[model samples]
Target: MAHWDPRGQVAPHVRRQVASLAAAVDELVVVSTADLDDDGAAFLGRHGRLLRRTNYGYDFFSYKTGLEASRPEDFDEVVVCNDTYVPLVGYGEVFEAMAGRPADFWGLTASQRVHPHVQSFFVAFRPWLVGSQAFRGFWGRMSPVSDRASVIAEYEVGLSRTLTDGGFRFASYYTETDADRALAQRRVAWWTLHRLPPPRRRREWEFLKARSKDPWNPAIALADVALAPSPPRPAGARLPYLKIDTLRYDPYGLGAERLLRLAERRRPEELAGVREYLAATAPLSAARPDTDLRPTPVGVRPLRRLVEYGRAA
Candidate 1:
């Protein structure tokens, strides 16, 4: 898994997540951009090889680095995922389901908004497709750039286009429905009507109660779906993983309360991990920061040493 943490330490939820996922794969490789501390590195090292790289091209480069070091061609299937979501169930079931499907590549979910493509957050590629020239050529051209938009456009979405043109097919595990669209749009609209800024935690949820629940923000509803899963309405809907984007960014109005409800109802096994993740990310306020800009370093001196990584990202 491609991993990053500002604290240079693994979160409790991620530790549990990695441990559970370890059983589903023959090998586990964690590529981290963060300069992990000794305990963090040792914990991850226990599972499999742990690599540290510069945070250059975001998660895709981390995926690239891991694949290069691990010899992906030797494996029957290779999965590229980031720590962007927390799987509520064990990956054994997810792998079991994907193995029965008939696609060269498959992901957790796909989106139709920006051409027909699988969201690249979590994708598994079959060996046949992985060995093809199209697969190699795509990665061969990857370059390190800080701008995320270009990475998504050229690599994330580009990979699907390249593979598809080469006669390889791709699929998604969680296919969204018209009902999901209605629900996602409604979710966006609810937050839009309330006009909530970036949310930090459940304490700010008081605004949700005080705000309108009309779900009729036409402009936002018409905006492209943010490629996130909607919250469970009936409360037991099948979402294989709870997207961290939904909770941390709240782009889809899928917050802690809905997730807690789902976990409390059916998947209590993951309740503790889910709670820790939520509390860690949940901010005390949605208020914007007053001083985000930082002053440049003096003389560009770091003890006469320079560390540059991901130059080929």
Candidate 2:
């Protein structure tokens, strides 16, 4: 598991997540970008191998560092997940459910924004995919780009495409049926309409959007059900996580609260620490202003032949 907090403090929910995940795997390696307190360090130490890296790259940077350091070739399965979400359900059911599935690799959910690909947050690699030359080359090609778009295009989307092109099959755990997908499309439209600015401007914004697609956003276009798990869950809608990003940066205002509320209603026992973390973080802003950023080591990763990429790396 890869975890990073800007303030270098570990929240109770995060700790619980890490510990809970630790129990499932034979070994868990946590690559932390931020410094941890003594208790945090001790807790992680008890759970798994803990490595510290400079906070220059994104999650994938930690991914590269951790994978290289741990030597994942020996493992039967390798799961790359991060602190970007809170898992509403524990891993036991999820793992058990997915065990019989025939996918060489799988994720909790998949999105069809630009194309079909698994969301990067919770991907599990079976030994078939994990031990391949493609797997090693994938990591070697990774350059933790500073921007989200490039990262998505290169690493996130590139991952599934690369593996698929290599003849490996992938699957999503909570596979949405045709009806569920239609519901998501409708929900997405509702969210886009409601997330508009106040009345007069909302009219203008609606008019503009009706004609132009310039402001079409990744989050908006990517209609994952985590962003819209309101009311009745569709059949087979057993996604384990509710993204923390949706809690803070819900650009569409598309029912992140409803998702949280649903989790609370279903399983309040697991939510106390999540609530505490939310209180500490104070998720008041829906969107963040574009801050001037420096070019960091965290960048992009593109797919390439093993031999060529090997020399480049």
Q: TM-score each candidate.
A: 0.71, 0.77
Model 1 clash tally, residue pairs = 4
Q: Which candidate is the best by lDDT?
A: 2
Tell me how far the alpha carbon of residue 18 in candidate 2 is from the true structure, in angstroms, after superposition.
Answer: 1.3
Deviation (Å) of 153 in candidate 2: 1.6
lDDT of 1 at 159: 81
Off by over 4 Å in 2: 194-237, 282-313
Task: Give candidate 1 misplaced runs (Cα > 4 Å).
Answer: 185-237, 253-268, 271-313
* Worst window of 10 by summed lDDT in candidate 2: 304-313
lDDT of 1 at 20: 80
